[model samples]
Target: MFELILGLPLLGGMVVMGSGWGISAVMFALHAVTLLMSLQHRQSFYGSAAGIVTCLLFSVPVWGMFGHWITAALLLVSMVDRYGAGMPGSFRRS
Candidate 1:
């Protein structure tokens, strides 16, 4: 399932780019991938929801790629916090 995060975005980017949206397609994939990964840990959904919105904005009035960094930052923080608990599937401390 983890691999799906990257694979899905690449698939989505290709489809969106086919419409001639170019760079916006990359932005869309960026947020979508982040949203998907974050949703996996079951922490919250709203952040991922926001990512989807950012993906949409990329297709419209959003003219810059910087906003994708926000999604990446959130993903980074969430992932760091997750691993701090120790690797997934490892035995937990009492």
Candidate 2:
């Protein structure tokens, strides 16, 4: 369910990219990689309802920009939250 945050825009981006939207391809890569990193950390979206909403907002097209601003801001905020929670930047599990 929460994975929709990562999936929706990703699929949409892929479709858009198929139509020759290069920017969508970039955004797709960005979200796919970040989402994979989150999974590698075993981070669950279960309690991050805010992420769902933000990502939903991110899925919507705003002024033909694909909501990159919202998604980028949420990514920064989420990274801060995870780091403050003692999740180090390294890939090693503690």
Candidate 3:
């Protein structure tokens, strides 16, 4: 699930750079579709799915907002998915 969220953009960027304009457009379209699916999946995880839906809807308006730091943001999100321990455990010793 996390991979789909993160990989689409990364792959889209690669395809965009490696090929012609048509390829890029297709990749971008696929990315949007996949994002919609992920948002729906996130919604299923929680009774409230607005958070993911809201995020997916905001991508267009937020374009270029991250500029060069987009990669960093993606990396961070991916890291949290892979390494983050959902919530802090009270059983841990200080």
Candidate 4:
């Protein structure tokens, strides 16, 4: 749920890179907060960390879009895996 919410800005940025630096700044802050929350919950933080990196490189046009795509993909995969592992009778590899 939170991952999906975080992904909205990334998708929006890809469509409109001209939204200015303010959006990127806000995203950076959001990612930072999310990272802290993930740490508190002991959940995976890779997606939020990647989001911070993406926000930092967001002014580079091409690289920014690429980063957004990669971050979004990472978030999606993490969300799926988190939920999958919680399912009953799911196989766990150690």
**Winning candidate number (TM-score):** 4
What is candidate 3's local distance difference test score? 0.40
User: Which pairs clash inside model 4?
Assistant: none
Candidate 3 wrongly placed segments (more than 4 Å): 1-18, 43-72, 82-94
| Candidate 3 structure quality by residue, lDDT tens digits, 4-93 | 332355653454346644543443455456556656755222211322332343243234223213433453454455446457753322
Give the TM-scores of the predictions, in the order they appear. 0.42, 0.42, 0.34, 0.69
What lDDT tens digits, residue by residue, belong to model 4 across residues 61-91? 5566667777888877767666766679986
Q: Over the stretch 2-94, how does candidate 2's per-residue lDDT look in tens digits?
A: 233333455645655566755444555555565666678787332243343444454455422334444545555665556554555644433
Computed on alpha carbons, the lDDT of every model, listed in order, comes to 0.50, 0.48, 0.40, 0.71
Best of the two (3, 4) by TM-score: 4
What are the runs in model 1 whose C-alpha is more than 4 Å off?
A: 1-19, 22-41, 60-63, 85-94
Worst 10 residues of 2 by lDDT: 44-53
Per-residue lDDT of 27 in model 1: 50
